[model samples]
Target: MSRFVRQSYYRHVYGQPSKREMCFDNIKVSASAWDTNLAAANPKFLSVNYQASGGGAFLVVPLTHTGKLPDLYPLCRAHTAPVLDTSFSPFSDTLIASSGEDGKIVLTHIDEDRLTAALRLEKPEVNDLEPVLRLSGHVRKAGHVKWHPVAENVLASTSLEVKIWDVEKAACVVELPQQPDMVGSMSFNWTGTLLATTCKDKKLRIYDLRSGELTSMADSHTGIKGSRVEWMGRLDRICTTGFSKFSDRQVFVWNSGDISKGPIKQLTIDTSSGTLMPFWSDNDILFLAGKGDGNVRYYEYEADELHYLTEYKSSEPQRGMCWLPRRALNTQDCEIARAYKVTNNLVEPISFIVPRKSDSFQADIYPPALSGKPALSSSDFFAGKTAEPILVSLDNLSETAAPPIKSSLYASTPVVPGSGAVSPALPPSEPPAPRSISRAPSPVSTKHDPLPSSSPAIEQPPVSHQPPPSSIVAPSVDAHPEQRSSSSSADVDQLTKENQELKDELAEKDCVIRNLELQLEKFKTNQMKIIELSKNSLN
Candidate 1:
């Protein structure tokens, strides 16, 4: 008998000398939640969040580079309560939205010029950062936020309910009630029109923005704790990771069109102690699940079945993890995937790459994608006065225009002020037959759980421990971008040559490994053939 297991890779750890010494020494990251990101990425900067004492304010530190960690200061401070989550605007690099325990979702614009002016004056007391707009829709602490992939000024945040807001107008375009339950996690489909979320009630709810309908609600993991959902690229399907009724962790694939059919396929991972945080690769065929054990497992999905490919193992478990957006990947180096893993004192960048011999740039692998500029401004979005979103796909990313969305629901009905009620703007097309919607019972409590207990919190359970006393929040002083001090050009040339030689040697080794694998498969085929022939002769 023979067995095949997953291949593992090496992780290049970053973030040294502790986050305290670097601009966030005075701030303490909240231990009560894990929704806040330790690190996030954009072309201009990498944003890091640190919690303030007593849920009053938080600092967002922006690093100018990748790979190496420097002793840099935070770029700005912009939250009143402990920020639960922060996300970059899909259309703009300077604008970002944050959800806080103070029940406010704020939009902040980072002015590089403002930061630079303060640095020039060496004024640590300069705190000019404030939310351009404060949205108060959630009754409790706002938990999670995500921007629309293609639409302009379309963003969603979760609390006891879900609110879709347009920063341009400083208004909520759509508010989704959680049916008296709390949402665990939510993900948008490829076209940015459909959303899939897991609720604390153990139900998978699908929301279609075009139709303004709940679409479908089906039974999910049935476990008591965590669940996360992700769309399978262009495929009208979603993959979810959660615990089963028996507390065994599992991953399942469902047909988004007809979730009533339930999961088409299910793969049980393990009965580990920690909940899994699932991240789908940019291409959408590969999925990685990072857990508390410091091991990140990767699998390839095809036709609803998952093939275990590899795992990124580490000695230290990750407290938080976030993958760089597709555009941030270095395709020229054949670097397919990268993630920032946040620990207690340091954050590291983990790379997942394909073993290839080619060193040339591949445009096909780096296809045209979304830009930071939105088609419509905030005023234009509100002037249109429609909850119906303009949908776009990856294939048409370069079109540079948002097609006009025509929906009678938004134009004809004037919304009642401060009321969470609006006309349903679903399916601008034909109507479909109504179907029955049911909810799954809570697996943990007998209270007929309406998703009120906990959040998926992602990656690790809501962190219960804060940073040590050694770290202290202090007034931020700007430090210049950390650059490697240049040495003599001759030494640099020698190093470059040596690096190229090492890459060539690696390519050769990869070639040899491929040949050996091919031979192994051939030998296995021959062995099977010989056994079959001998059995026939005996018969």
Candidate 2:
């Protein structure tokens, strides 16, 4: 019989299990801009709209490894009006495009290092970064700009009308005339063969890019005007949102295969006061919707379940939010997620940290006699001798054995099963016949002593088996010698250098302070002497 030591029981209770934890960091950008837009290059770099002062500016900040933001790069400074929308080129990492209220769309290639140094310098020192191409054709503010997903040089801008431009040729490729109201949002399918636009007239229209013809048009929201339209990840599905005060603010997911038909899934929002800002993830498995109530809700498409995973509250209403893509960081592929908010005078962007499991540790050893114990099998360990022992019978073993039952060993009295039950026992069955009895021999007869029985009779034992206690050794916690030596040596050297530098600085300050004190004392002495001379002259 094997016995478990008390130390093992305590180890099971106090040991730290593997856990997943997450932390969040925020970055503030562009001072006091009410109308702003944001975009990112795989979360490593971000571009935000600085829509104050005369025209507006674009601030590009680097997401540092320590979760802090470095200085911003001011890109695309030629617009004479507030930038309405900005987007990073999906085809190229270095390219960025922006549209302004000045009715112009500008494309620029950013030099990240030079921009970072310029923003760190003092004000009035302007950087020479300029846009590569600037197109001006729209009569009103270009409310939205989107890059063609498949084509490299193809771009689209929407305002009063939707216009497609070939950036390399510096000319408009095609133009689609709009209805009475302005076009609010525009997006292209993954293949760039189809384009979808949402108009203020509460209509969602899809166009065939090859022929430049109106393929299909559907009335998305009856009472509310359409605000945005997004093509759900390479699929034939598209999502659109509406903006209205009295009407219900809702999102409609439609199948692009037949655009004239109504939406398949209509997600409704509370018509209180908040606006729904929807962002689709790359996998299309999840999409996040932010509301004016300051909650970020996540919805899975397949399960049709909306999980309120996380939320951040703001005193002011939310403006907009978007997700960054996955990229390589220090040779490892990682996804960096971020959300941008424009609330009151603050422009804040929040990022999330992915939780990871703890590092591996040494495994505990068990004795050979008890090596067949099951690890983490509470039923096998807790059940008494009455219960079947399948694990021990099968000889299954693991490094960390399950905890044994201690109550059975320490309890003085055992509780019998079905003990205090009422009623009487059933009638006993008939007994079996007795075997034939052998004749007893005369006492002290030396001739033939009856041979002693070969097998001895053993009585049944109790359920609890108390085994001897074994010495329990705790795991070592000391650091390795190499690690300790290197840490101490580095710390000593750093402290010595820092101490010398501090002493030099302090000595210099002390000299300056002593000089000032000496000057004050001399001035006081001169004043006292003059007072004495004046008194003598007066006498």
Best by lDDT: 1
RMSD of each: 21.5, 34.4
Candidate 2 C-alpha lDDT tens digits along 3-26: 963332112111111111121123
So what's the TM-score on candidate 1? Answer: 0.64
Name the 10 consecutive residues with the lowest summed lDDT in model 2: 9-18
Q: What global local distance difference test value does model 1 have? A: 0.58
lDDT of 1 by residue, 198-306 (tens): 8778889898654457889899898887688887655566888899888899888888878988997888888885667778764433555455678877775544557
After superposition, the stretches of candidate 2 with alpha carbons farther than 4 Å from their true spots are: 1-43, 65-75, 119-124, 243-246, 303-317, 328-337, 344-539
Residue 227, candidate 1: how far off, in angstroms? 0.8
lDDT of 2 at 282: 38
The count of residue-pair clashes in candidate 1 stands at 13
